[model samples]
Target: MDIHAWQLWILAAIIAGSLEMALPGFVMLWFCVGAVVASLAAAVGLDINVQLALFTLISVTLFAASRTLFKKAFMRNASTVKTGVEAMVGQEAVVTESLVEGYGGTVRINGELWSARPLGGPVAEGERVIVEQVEGLKLWVRRPAASLEVPLKKKEGR
Candidate 1:
């Protein structure tokens, strides 16, 4: 029994499309397109060689076009936002030690000692400050806009 050219093309298209579910992306979409083209060629009474040639050309062109279009759509904007300690902008903390210029100083933030720096004015020990920015492993800090001044203790009557 002889199988028709159109039957072979239709079989190839179904197999290619089914394989795509197991794999990922548009890898098999092009092959399915090629099979359809081959089937069309067979319907027009084209010889087996011409059908094969058309299939090859359509498959390659579709694969290349899909790859280019997918890259532009998915890969161009795939960057993620920084989080955790890297996202501590504008946070407030207290200086656990004095911050001298050009030296690493320690600040207490969220019950942790973090390497810190004075962005402008010197930050004394126990002073409340706000995190201005982050530079490498250190945090640039500044004094808060207002301070919570504690009242002095009163002396007992003589």
Candidate 2:
């Protein structure tokens, strides 16, 4: 029982397209395109070796071309609908605990408790701070410069 070259090429195309669904990002799409091209070559009576070489060349070229174009398109259409830690940036939250240098503290953002750090000063408990950045599950924070005040209790005690 021998399978025709056309049948092999069609099978490759179907498998490539199916794999695209399981592992998306347009990676397998170029292979599927190549397989289709190979199938057409087979229909035109091209030898199997030529068909294979053509498939490899076409797939590589298409993948490179699509990757460049996709990146450009993706960048142009990007949006900031924050999800996860990204959403915490620019949000205001009260320091639930003091953030000592080299130590972690906690803050509540969007009703969720998160590990936080003061940018460059001790953030006393109940001090309002704005999230400057998020690294992993931790939030970097600072008192908005305009709202900063000297701590009277600390100054008097020193």
Number of the predicted model whose TM-score against the real structure is largest: 1
Predicted structure 2: clash tally:
0
Cα lDDT for residue 89, candidate 2 = 89
Model 2: per-residue lDDT, tens digit, 94-147?
888888778969988888888998898888888889999989888999987784
Q: Per model, state how many residue pairs clash.
A: 0, 0
Q: Which residue pairs in model 1 clash with each other?
A: none
Deviation in Å, model 2, residue 87 alpha carbon: 3.8
How close to the true structure is residue 151 of candidate 1, measured as C-alpha lDDT? 89
Error of 2 at 45 (Å): 4.9
Highest lDDT scorer: 2
The lDDT for every candidate, in the order shown, is 0.87, 0.89
List the candidate 1 regions with Cα displacement exceeding 4 Å. 47-50, 67-80, 83-98, 107-114, 124-158
lDDT of 1: 0.87
Query: lDDT score, residue 17, model 1?
Result: 96
